[model samples]
Target: MNRYKHRAYNEELMDDLTAGGPSMDQTLRELETINRWLGGNFVTIDGLVKLLKKSPSRPLVIADLGCGGGDILKLVARWASKKKLEVELVGFDANPHIIEYAKENCKEFKNIRFEVQDIFSEEFKQREFDIILCTLFTHHFTEKQLTGIFRQFKSQAKIGVVINDLHRHPLAYHSIKLLVNLFSKSEMVKNDGPLSVLRAFKRKELVQLMNDAEIDRFTLQWMWAFRWQLVF
Candidate 1:
């Protein structure tokens, strides 16, 4: 596999689910496990912490774009509760079933709500959010699409945006392949995990994309377990 070139987008099987079947739900739960153990949640929380330090206000509204299983937002809700900070966490997803799954998982947290909306649609563009989060979400798009998304994030986010995504590299790819094979039972997780690494970004490639998006006020850092923490 040529690590230098960006691979074509492969649709994740979980993205196509229309109903909450066992396999689909298992895949999402497995993904939440993978993210939690692999430092995915920490990276976004780090960015969120920085944002909170800058703007110490009550009732902070945060939107998790493409929130899968709503794990990250739920985690955020718990953290906010510990800090005694009032927050409204909204999860936006294109799939209704997925939204339902997330809502079920996060039902205990009254501060979190799930909404089914396409990110590229007019409603998403018109709506404003205090902080926009893209956690393990951006790699699915093409460079052009990412550029536009970044532009939209810049315009719509009042405080800023936090993106925690994969870093494509040979070591990261092979390590995840081995782990997925050993631990994952779901076919969707087995197939899409390594493919996600292929679809991920290099440091310079992300910088160029940010430049193309005309977004400069950002910090991109490589976090542990092959993730990029981009705070804008």
Candidate 2:
């Protein structure tokens, strides 16, 4: 087994600053599919279900950070609708094109909307959300950045924060490496899929980061398909 336990900051093709086109859109679509099949969406859904329990009577306002295709937000919106719960869902992403794509894809859901936002900006810090959900997003940041981000999340979220992200392990890395190479059509997917695993966290690493962020009231659970479901 490979024994290294440090985060790798390799550049993912999908993170290309100047990249925006049909291929970028295709890659995002593929990522949504992967999340669906790998049960990545369920991780956040489960956390949301728990968070919803805290304030059952109030109208809920939820925000999904780094919402590429807004798939998770759409799923949450549908779940809330089916339960007859009054809820508003918002999706945030820094890329304008991705935000446009998310809006177009989620146009059928009136309760869900998209916004272009830098999560670290003063505007984001000023806004308050009942529940903030992050899926497969935290791995993109360094530990120092994550500490600051988590602290902000604690300050801005009124109810709680749900973080669903990859677990870095030799098995996870190799399994995704094989699966993406075989099933993905986009070059960005073929490159970034495994790279994300390398950038992902170990359980201890997340625990330490949370400690550094000064967030104490939280539970971290290991979910299926190598995901960390953290609720704060």
Report, for every candidate in turn, its global Cα lDDT versus the true structure. Answer: 0.88, 0.89
Against the correct fold, how does model 1 do in TM-score?
Answer: 0.96
Ten-residue segment with the worst summed lDDT in candidate 1?
Answer: 12-21
Candidate 2 local lDDT, residue 120: 84
lDDT (0-100) at residue 115 of candidate 1? 95
Model 2: residues >4 Å from true position, as ranges? 1-3
lDDT per residue as tens, model 1, 42-70: 99999999877854656888999899899
By lDDT, who's the top model here?
2
- Each model's total of backbone clashes: 0, 0
